[model samples]
Target: MSGRQEQINLDTLEPQQLAQVKKQLDEELEHLTNSFAQLHAAQNKFKDCLRCVKSRSGAPEDIGTGFLVEKKLKSAEKFYESKVEELGNNLKDLEVIVQRKQTNARTIEEVLRQKILASQGQDQQQA
Candidate 1:
């Protein structure tokens, strides 16, 4: 629950432990949000680079150094393409983790809160 890259950590808790689980869920969701933002920025940058490469390719290269620049751009284009795929995969994984965590925390919190309320009602009735 350090809010790092990894997902939720519910270890070392009692069977019905809830607070720590909630904490881990919150941290995981936040981490996923941050990662998604980073991936989006990378995707936009890759698109910009792609546009530049395409535009340059259409230019009539009637001078030296054009080939070199084109070659460099090709290499960069490949790199960006691979990066886009990688980021997309990462985004998908984080999305799954976040969704799972959200469901689990909500379920557990609802159960625990209801249990607490029921116990309070019993105590008042007995008093």
Candidate 2:
């Protein structure tokens, strides 16, 4: 997986299977967390490079490959900027997914709690 969200039919899963799915979601969330950190570091590196490029004087070779290198560097800066935007969007999406998963897990927990409470009530009444 590209650390992207998968479509799960939560209604079709048994409680045990839902727990398994939650575990898998947790693992995926951990992976995405690391990926986010790495992406942020890479974004910082790209920003630094862009700053360095912008601060430099004219190319050393007044009319040759130095100029070409400078041009390519500018092009690379644009590319990196686009990549950063894309990563930011991905991060946002991942956050939304994490939130949804948490909500679902909480809902499941509440349901389980209610079931336990009901079972206890029944036992007390029988006793």
Candidate 3:
């Protein structure tokens, strides 16, 4: 059935065919779950490496230039952090606006549907 249009309706499938499909789905799910676990482990290891590198970079007092460098790095980090926070707040505001707009759209659609049904009923009565 490769590259061919074949539609198999589950409601009309044979018992054996349904069982085969279920087995294939189960195997695929297992493979995907295992892959996700491996990826999660790799991510954790990467985070650990980052922490280790930061720890090994030495204290600011150990070197004269290190203090100045550390201070500048910290200032930059704070600036980035504040920017991220501001962006996050903006994103939340946008989400609220989107939700309100969606609600309004649904309400409008329902009202239109009711009016159409009422008009159809009146037409039927007149006929």
Candidate 4:
């Protein structure tokens, strides 16, 4: 990378432009949040099913039926575990995106603050 600093004046954007960017970030964050909630719900459902399966009564009268049920439940548990892992990976990706957008918003805010202070200094100087 070159040692020369690249000048990026975020203040060059109009307030409307900043607002639009903020809105986009907010909408994306909201969507990701909803997705996480849905994923959590799915994970919870799987956990609940697993718990229910584990708590089943081991009665000798239903040995054959119990074996079939246990086999199916084990298969379902494996499937749900894989799905949970996939959802977790997706959740991690969304979190990273959200973090990046937050950083961008903060940087823009700092730039706007600087612009305001600079304008104030100019006004004071003109006085």
Candidate 5:
């Protein structure tokens, strides 16, 4: 990428235009940062998940001890998987929230335009 930046026309933008742009940039940055964090976190989680297989690969424990360790390791794997699934669900919820906000914003924009036109009509009628 070229190390160049173009001047923005923020000065000429209506208040609504500026606000919408800011909202979009904020959402995009949030998603980008979250995804990057999740990527690194998942790498670490995979490393931790190896414990599921490692418990069986090492020197054999006593038969009685082996059952306990296997049980514990299986529990740990379940816990880890559940945590990852919870995070995935949380991300989905966030997506739903952002979608709701977009819908609400559009609704507000329409209402504002209607109000503005109504006020303009009243002004003309009075004139």
Candidate 6:
């Protein structure tokens, strides 16, 4: 009854039960074969449809070339837009880093200036 096929002990089954099980298995096999044939026919029909679509020639509008091109252009536009957005974010991050470095450089310059002034004062006093 479940997805798994349970092993039946043929020796334990009565003669009537064994005959009924065999008949049921035969019916199941027939049904499966019929279903497989139907699926194969349907697949062949789809292949025929693909062949027709590929071989038919008409105006670009009639054959959907315009729709396909528009779809492709939209996809490319979205890709480039995303790339531009990513680049913008990267530029903002770089700007922040540059600002931080500039601040650090100014702080170091002020410290050096203070040291120079102190040394000059000490030298003047010694002279």
Residue-pair clashes per candidate = 0, 0, 0, 0, 0, 0
Residues 1-127, model 2: lDDT tens digits: 3456567665556656666766776776677677767877877787777677677666544456446666766777788778777777776777776677667767666555565676689999999
lDDT of each: 0.71, 0.69, 0.53, 0.70, 0.61, 0.53
TM-score of each: 0.71, 0.65, 0.49, 0.69, 0.43, 0.48
- Ranking by TM-score, best first? 1, 4, 2, 3, 6, 5
Residues 1-127 of candidate 5 have per-residue lDDT tens digits of: 1236455455455556756766775676577557756755784576577565555645434566446555666677777777767766666665565565466556545555665676689999999
Q: Taking the tens digit of each residue's C-alpha lDDT, what string does model 4 give over 29-127?
A: 688678778877887787677677666655335356556655666677778677767777876777786677678778877766676677789999999
lDDT of 3 by residue, 1-127 (tens): 0136455555455445555655654565455455545545554554555454445544455355535555655665565555545545554554554454455445444554565676689999999
The model with the greatest TM-score is: 1
Residue 110 CA displacement from its true place in model 5, Å? 1.6
lDDT value, candidate 5, whole model:
0.61
lDDT string, candidate 6, 17-117, tens digits: 55566566556545555554554555455455545444555543423543754454445556555554554555455455445445544544455456567
* Reference-based TM-score, model 4: 0.69
Off by over 4 Å in 2: 1-25, 59-67
Model 3: colliding residue pairs? none
lDDT preference between candidates 5 and 6, better one? 5
The lDDT, on a scale of 0 to 1, for candidate 1 is 0.71
Q: What is the lDDT of residue 67 in candidate 2?
A: 60
Reference-based TM-score, model 2: 0.65
